[model samples]
Target: MTAPPDRRIAAHRPDLADRRLEGLVAAGQFVEGERWRIALASVPLRAAPRPDLPFETEALRGEVVRVFEETIEGWAWGQIETDGYVGYFSADALGPLAPEPTHRVIVPRTFLYPAPDLRRPPREALSLGATLALGEAVETRGTLYRMTADGAAAVVDRHVAPLDAPHADDWVAVAEGFLGAPYLWGGRTSLGLDCSALVQLSLAACGIAAPRDSDLQESAVGRPAEGPPRRGDLVFWPGHVGLVAADETLLHASGFQMQVVREPLAGAIARIGAPRSIRRL
Candidate 1:
């Protein structure tokens, strides 16, 4: 018999499943979900349809989700296209799919403005790795801003890089930039994030794709390494993961400290136990 699907990434439930899984899984009904785009800066993707449910992850602006079901209570059951994470997203956070994104946010976070002028009150802050479909450029007060494809907002040009731009040479430095960011349970933004999210977001800025959870990342991110950990090496424990910052320092979003921090490898091992594996990119 085939193994059961991992529910975190599988678009399946007892009552409904993705049309592609019709033969492999049992469900009350199968549907070919419609594509939708995240319209807000960020929105929680919860495991259940209730507001009280802790988020499983977060969907960032411009990401696409395949929505299979919608409820009158403002929940939309869907799977994220980028990470294949399955969850219930707030219906209001989604909109009709827009034009393909041409650029991606390269900074930790940036403000979206209502006009090209930076002096105007900002609209929202977009997190790193958020994709944007940009139109023409406009300069005001010596600042260059790129207008959204629909002309709904503007973003500082330097804050985003073209989709085809070369990746960062030092992704670890990218991760280090988040030092002191709050450790949120299931967040994936610069405002707040979890351990796996720290890895995922940092790698994404360097043009690498990663799984959404620590266990999945531990298995899929890179090849195994067997020596002293070096910068950028991924260190994993049973339910957690971190990156080697230096010879003996580990950089991670620590739940213990409620923030991203750099701690000695020996101290981390003492607190969390020996690492299960270490992998190098």
Candidate 2:
């Protein structure tokens, strides 16, 4: 029989004992081999099956993953569809494989209400980039009812954009909205984000594809910009990166400040030292 595809994140994970998995796979009992969507606001993709394990990536609400295996402990081994990131998540976090997403959140954060009225308490807060399936438009109430992959229903403002819609040609403008978000090493949502995540999210909203890490990002969309720095350019250091807010201002989710913020490019250069290169996406 053929072996399971080698997922980079799953490589060398000691817990994935080859003999045990191979036996199950050869017997046709290893994986469910189904597609699913994330039902929660965010879920950790852990290195191990347990919650105590460290996570290097996350699955955002409404994103799809293809299940490769399931454990009795209720964990699902899978590969994220967006970037092919692989890991394990709680089985409870998954919902039925969804139809194509119809709309995407454009704001940093917003609430999903139980009904169309703002007077009612919100069911949950959805972070930026969460997608929704449009249900019904109730213009008079200034809200739109929507459905999730799990068949859950909620109402939100008409403020969302079509799923395929691009915010604009300038990616810098998209990055600016994340100002003040807390820094998280592998986060990509508005709840907490890292430098590469900020860049990825910003470019993604502008309909550009970006890789997950600083070095990968540097290799992906980067093209050396002629002349000095300018707005919308990307500046890379050894292990870090940031967006050019202007000719002299830089925006990034910095570990130094522990949050996303704007700082003078010269000051950042003086503190963080010289950038490896400045590229325009």
Candidate 3:
């Protein structure tokens, strides 16, 4: 018999499945999902279609999602194209796919302005790694801004870089920037994030693709290392992961402290137990 699908990334349920899996999986119906782009700064992808449910991950602005189902209650069952994580997302957070992204936010966080001027009320706050489709540049006073393709908002020019720009050389330094950020169960934004998200986001800024969860990350991110952990090395536990910031320090979004923090490696091991493996990126 064939092995069962990994539901975390599988676009399947007892009632339906993506048409692409027609022969590989069994379901009551198969669909050719419609593509939709995330229009909000960030939207939660939950395991269920209820507000009370905690999200499994977050879909960033401009990311495409292939929607397999929609409900009148304002939920959509979809798979995030970037990470291939399937879940329920708010229908309102999605929009038509058009004017494809041209730039990506490179900073930890930035605000979207209704106008180019800083004095104007902000429209939304976007997090690192979010993509945007920008039009021509505009200047208000001494600051330069890029207008959104739809002209709905503007972003500071320095906050974003061309989508094709080179990645940062030090992803560990990128992760350090999130020190003190709140630990969130499924969040992937700078405002709040989980352990895996911290790893994924940091690597993404360095143009490296990583899986969305700790297990997948531990298996896919890097080759196994046999010696003492060094800076940029990823340390994995049973269900958690962190980066070795130095010979004796660990950096991670710690649920114990409820925030991202750096602490002595020995202390962390004492609290969380010894790491299962170390992977050098």
Q: Over 4 Å off in model 1, which ranges?
A: none
TM-score of each: 0.98, 0.84, 0.98
Better of 1 and 2 by TM-score: 1
lDDT of 3 by residue, 52-129 (tens): 999799999999999999999999999999989999988999988998999999999999999898999898999999
Error in Å for residue 10 of model 1: 0.5
Superposed Cα deviation of residue 127, candidate 2 (Å): 1.8
RMSD (CA, Å), each prediction: 1.0, 4.6, 1.0
lDDT of 3: 0.93
Show pairs that collide, candidate 1. none
The lDDT-based order of candidates, best leading, equals 3, 1, 2
lDDT of 1 by residue, 1-281 (tens): 99769989999988999998888899999999999999899999999988888879999998999999999988999999999999998899888786889999998999999999898999999999899999999999899999999998899999998999998877789998899999999999989999999999999888899999999999898999868788899999988999998777999999999999999999999989989999999
Ten residues in sequence with the least summed lDDT for candidate 3: 2-11
Q: Looking at model 1, which ten-residue stretch has the lowest summed lDDT? A: 93-102
Q: Supply every candidate's count of residue pairs whose N, Cα or C atoms clash at under 3 angstroms.
A: 0, 0, 0
